[model samples]
Target chain A: MIQAISASDYLQPVHDGAALPPLEAALKNLCRERFRRIDRFIQLALLGSARCVAGRTLQPDCGIYLGSGLGPIGNNILTQQQLIRDAEIPKPVNFVNTLGSSAGFHVARNLGLRGQNFFISRRGASLQAVLGAAMADLTHGVVGQALVGVVEEVTLPLGEHRLRQHLPEDRTLAEGSHWFVLQPGTGDSRSLDLKRFAEFATLEDFLKSVWRTGDRLCCARSMETHAAKTMQRGFDAGALSGPTSAFHDSLEAAWLAAFAVSREPGTLFLVDGHPERGWSLFYLGA
Target chain B: MAGAYIRGVGLSCALGEDAESGVSAMQRRQVRPVVLRLDEFDEPLQMPYYRIPDRAELFDAGRLERLLPPVARAAVAQAGLTPEEIHRLPLFIGSSCFSIGLSESRYAAALAHQSETAIPMPLCGYQDIAAILQRALACRGDTYTYNTACTASANALLGALRMIELGWYRHALVVGAEWANRTTLAGFSGLQIVADALRPFDAARKGIVLGEGIGAVVLSAETDSANRLRVIGGASNCDTWSVTTANTNGKSVAAVLNQALEQTHLRPRQVRGIKAHGTATPAGDTAEALGIRQVFAGLPPLSVLKPYLGHTLGACGINELILFAGALQRSFLPATPGFETPDPALGVQPIITPEAAPDGHYLLNHFGFGGNNTVLVLEKTAP
Candidate 1:
């Protein structure tokens, strides 16, 4: 019942003043008045979702499921800094954007989606969790269609913290948005299906029980060392982007889900594990 | 499949520590206003906040860790679930600022010391509330955290109910915790939504008085005479008209309310009463009043609980659920506190007098920031 009809993503690498792509024209075309108050994160989310829908007339009950690691952190930190430094009053616009799910609201508002839209914070596996929830809803027929997405904005505060830990210097902290349109598929062979998804309390349990017969294993570099070692030995390891993220992992899974139809029947094993959130394994393909 | 029933509930607020005590104190209308004089604010702002009175050691890093676990334990114990059952229990928690009070302090301390003390990981990113609670309660089932501002815990409950209906889990624990923080205080103060006193659904209503505490519920597929109340159904949606405020036209909220009734197969007349999300903000109350009037032909005896418990924000979903469910179980409808005169323009009136609980159903509405609106319908079964 969890049919993944199509998927798409919008990614960007870190650079000097590499701002979010200009979505104003496209957003304005969708809804001019509501686009005025959207923040960078929301703009990113709308763009990703817009690309996925591709002008397809959607049902009013389309659910918007968005996930973020540091949701609107850039703006949140900036607002907090202004409050601390200048003793300035908190702006209602800035405060609203800081709610983590602001983008979900903006997207729903712009798209005229009246279904359930939620924004959950799951550090490294936010989008996966969001996708999992969407699949549950779709399989149960709670929603006609669900637009699942993840947006993260790498902020200076987060970068400074990462630097302090001396983890990966050129870790390539980036901002990106990835969205997938999940709904019941017609008799289209091009459609990619979500085979299974499981959440484990520990990496050990996840590795021991994750699906094996797959064309490749896709995951973030920093997901888990032991599991990565085992995956490398067992399957064709398809390393996600070096600048690892839940958004990136989801994009990779979507790619694999879409690409699976071009070749012989096979599976794509995706494992995403976080220090605090344990492990999530997703099997996407035929 | 057995319906998901509220086996036990635990809440800590201005009312009391546990649900039974909190419900009792809420019925008695016991309130203590919390005054705020933070470094960010020039004047000492006075607002009605329902903080746990017994724990007056000021906000600190460990406030949530200290306040939440006991409530979780109490709910689990009240449900008569053994430690083994708890260990295998799935948990879903909602929070607007999960451990932000602690994270902010850590960031401040690092600044003071001028030391790169590896910016406490939780501060750099989101705190996994499920992981924190799992460690606290020693439970290991699937966990999720919903963060849709005020409707956070309501979504948590909705998610748990879906999983239970799917036969994925037999029992689930839903928790909501939100403590007052400088950012929220300043943000509301700047928006001019903070009222000097908590006055929900009143003619001269001010804005919300932010409160803090934790609320938890143990939902199980099994039901005994002790806890037979069933979670009938619910619906949640985004207004998308506004981010900070709901649509004054009331179309979006009314749609969601109508959806809840449709899904539950109950008419407005069948609904015994409604727990309005009367935050007392001008736009909020106006929209809610209009929404309720549009959905219910004859407005059920409305009760606003925020005046008694204060607005717990994200925690309001679970906190208010526990409080209202407890009253319904006792067949007692607590009168809407702090409602003296109805605003004529609002066009809806609440039951100012206490009444008996209707044997059919009750609806609870929790509308939140970013136009996130959630409504839950709880059905009362015969004993």
Candidate 2:
């Protein structure tokens, strides 16, 4: 078991064809020059991770597990265009940013750490898979600490084709970055345990076993149908209405869950689901 | 860490369709250049690559659907596993191009305002490699796909090892598949790294020949088994000095090598051989050479597979790893066929002639863009 030490999120509402979220001052605070030419997916990931380790002492041995719905899609499109249309050579930054793992290196360089860095792309389940892997690594003593995170950028091809395929129109195309520190321990009385289920037979079976009677439910918009029905069935639910209630992606759902858990000190079940990818249920708080 | 044995390995590359034949060709120093005709270019662009023969027809069925399943099935069969067992075993896959070859053509069709309905659903995402493999192999367990440039599949192996060590799963299948695509070809062409011939670790080495192949390995936690090679330990780290290139000093690369050795509880002298990730690129060769020297006082007999297999990119991790294990079992190290004169700057010489396989552990390295570096220690245990 591992404790969630800290959590940070950098989310932006992206309209259908909006450009990638502008790099905020938080990202500029750490490594402004380094963030210049990189794509927006990378910028969001680093910005969120920077906030995650903000006031805390940096752990050089900490690993980074980044999950992206579409790895470097923006840069991939740009590089493809340059090669086909302009017949121009790819710039150094364009080539580098086009790689899938570039964001992990960017975060690690800014944080000045050297440890295992893994970048996985699982489309809808990217965040869930990364978090599960992070918890397993921490439980196995793979590292002293880990920055487990996810970043998704609303590029035209990605937002229209990939994200919109699964998400309903009400949800809108979303992009954000979320990061948390995973450390070994039960932490405190209010710390919620993190467990990875290889295969879950049903959400009800999972809830009946671990969830307390008063545990609140938080979920991504993708899970609205099932989650709504489950909540209506009256199974330990709360916080359906709040300021941070509108969440489109897994990162936003996780960020809101973390924030709610920290403030209220109660159960916050963050559920993210995709038919093709399966379900990721995060039990937060005590 | 818990012990993970390489119970089975499967491969389909330029050398051969199976591990044994690929190893045989390597030992025999067979050389060939497979070519892919890019229809996108106007003036007949036939890019040279290490492509599997007669797989283009399979691409018509589906790109990843063609390459991934056969290799995965072969690996599972060699492991003496059934479809029922595979349904329970989680999958960890890595690839730089997961059917991107098919996607490129579809994207072009879309760009030309053609009907996008012709594109298959499987070609849409990189995760399709795992998805297709899972359905084909009856593996419904958890799946993870790593895409860290060239080091992708190596990192996937590391993940499988760590998870098995944590007792998360008793067995996991690690698979890697990269196919030749116009986008990747254009990308590398723009970088100007494609060499006329691959001459890894050679003084006159030019650059790299892009290749495409698929490789798979079945890893089980059961020790005291009859597997020939076992994954003892490994490490992966990134150098932030550059994204497209390695840190010139090779400090991070050296650290990862030391880390793998330390974790495996082995000394430099204990390792009998090394499989260098010699891409034949000038900067890549230099960094790897320096890193190897820093780890071992007198480097063990080293070999470069890229000369024989070409640079398979993401798939090279599993492809080269399986071939290495096969070569050791055959009691012969494949010669670096193109190596004539060693670069004095590297201060190391690759095994230009095939040599008798030494019994012990071997160090395997795979470095990629964004400075992702991985080193694995594999022990050749007596059956």
Best-matching candidate per lDDT: 2
Off by over 4 Å in 1: A15-34, A161-166, A189-214, A219-266, A271-281, B42-44, B115-122
Q: Kindly list the per-residue Cα lDDT of model 2 for residues B191-246, writing each as its tens digit.
A: 87888888887889888898878999999887445567888878888787887767
Interface quality of candidate 2 as DockQ: 0.45
**Local error of candidate 1 at residue B209 (angstroms):** 1.4
lDDT of 1 by residue, B1-383 (tens): 63489988888887888889888886776667666666545654545466677654656667777777889988898889977778778787788877556655666666567644424323544545666788888886656678889999998898888878776668899999887676677777778898877667688998888887789899998888766488877998888777776798888889999989987888888999898888988889988988888887877888888877788888899999998898888887777777788788888877777789968888999988877899998988788
Q: For residue B187, what is the lDDT in candidate 2?
A: 72
Q: Write the per-residue lDDT of candidate 1 for residues A73-155, one digit (tens) a residue.
A: 66766666555444666688887677876788878876778789888755565656677677767776778888887776655
What overall lDDT goes with each candidate model? Answer: 0.73, 0.75
Q: Model 2: iRMSD?
A: 4.0
lDDT of 2 by residue, A1-286 (tens): 6677787766666665556556756566766355567677788778888887776765787989988766766677676566444445556577667667888988888888778888986666677678777777777676778888887666654334443246555565566777787777775633535444433457657777777766677665545475547644657576542335334335543554356335565576767653433456777675
Ten-residue stretch with the least lDDT total in model 2 chain A? A240-249
